[model samples]
Target: MSVDNRRVDASPSPAAPPPPDPGAAYAPGPARPPGPASRLRRFATPVGILAGVVGAFGYVATFDPNEPGHYPVCPLLGLTGVYCPGCGGLRSAYAFAHGDIGTAFGANAVAVVGYFLFAAVWVLWMVRAGRGKPLRIGLAPVYWWGIGALLLIFSVVRNLPFGSALAP
Candidate 1:
């Protein structure tokens, strides 16, 4: 018998079956495995952050900022004969750690404040991480600008002869 090419085979056949339902065909994909990279990141990030905090405080505990050469000299101060705002931070931290608040303030009031700020922020970060939440601070544009201006002023002041006390 000759087959009719023009006529369509509309009827469902006994042997050949219809395609499965789209909904039924899709089984929920198996829960994705926690990949190696993600696992590494999860463990590494928090520990690194914590280690940094501890290392900072540890340096403050062990070293006296008043003494020279424990920390590296500020290249900016030496090279340009100008004091950067950060010149005496390590010494300030050492003073603050040793309960010589007056000396810390004399060394660098701003760095002392920064050390406390870092401690507080790190505590907040640890608390949030413990609760399975990430800690993030997004300052407003005005605040950022203000911070920049403050740093600039500090740099300028520390370099001036009258601001010698603020210098290292």
Candidate 2:
């Protein structure tokens, strides 16, 4: 018997179907075409958010929360005889809007931090929106729990005699 040494699998295979064109995905496939409004639509949400924020801050800046009958008392504080995390949020906002950082912090240090945090996140959201990218706040469960715990601690601490400094 003669032994054959030739390789059986060296034959050229069909050129892989031209790689699904990378640009094909972007090609307007004769379907609904993009228009000027589509570009503007991307900005609508972010701009609306900013406008609402500005409007709210404007109201807070104009109307004093410290004034009687302007804002309602916090229900939790009213009923529970304890300071809730948001007990003085409006006062903090009012103080912050008027550039009284010290009073804002005195009212609610956590709320002051929240104000700065919101500002930072809003700036980031605007930048992403302007770039046509989605602004996602995908915090993990752990982060959420940490925030809850921090608030809980703040609530408890403020109600204690030692934490009067944190009271609204």
Candidate 3:
């Protein structure tokens, strides 16, 4: 006897478990606007960060780094007679805090740039905090490596005769 080629059971599949109640699972939706207390709590971290930075700048502004006894010398400069990228950072900060932009740049242009960068980042962080949104600084590995390379190049150039301007 010839066997039937077609299958006998042609029933439709069961309905998919009512497409799992989206509400049941924790699906991220628009974040609830923070209340006054919650918003204040969020500001606490950014404010603390600002306070710490201001305190540091205040200390640097008060204590003169140009005085030999106040700040320690860069170990690299002391040992290898090489000017590190951060060799004049304290002096730069001192001049920057005192509103002497030219001297700050002369002390260390990169450090002056760093101060501005910090200010920009801090402002952005404060803005995000005020808006109840988390500030995210997600830099790629390449960017970090590039920064390292730039510092290295700056150090090397400052030590060279032609790059005397970069020296502290």
Best candidate, lDDT: 3
TM-score: the better of candidates 2 and 3: 3
Per-residue C-alpha lDDT of model 3 across residues 18-127, encoded as one tens digit per residue: 66675696768788985655878878988898899899999999999999899888998999999999989999999999999999998999999998998899899989
Q: List candidate 1 stretches off by more than 4 Å.
A: 1-48
Enumerate residue pairs that collide in model 3. none
lDDT of each: 0.77, 0.86, 0.90
Error of 1 at 131 (Å): 3.5
In candidate 2, what are the lDDT values of residues 48-76, reduced to their tens digit?
88789789989988998889899888888
Best by TM-score: 3
lDDT of 1 by residue, 1-168 (tens): 987789778887678567778777675769887544444454466679878867887777797756776777789877887778787777777777778888888888788888778779877876666665667899999999998899999889877888877776
lDDT at residue 88 of model 1 (Cα atoms):
77
* Model 1: per-residue Cα lDDT at residue 57: 70
Give all TM-scores, in the order shown: 0.65, 0.75, 0.77
Question: Model 2 lDDT vs. the true structure?
Answer: 0.86
The best-first sequence of candidates by TM-score reads: 3, 2, 1
Q: How accurate is candidate 3 locally (lDDT)?
A: 0.90
Considering summed lDDT, which 10 consecutive residues are worst modelled in model 2? Answer: 28-37
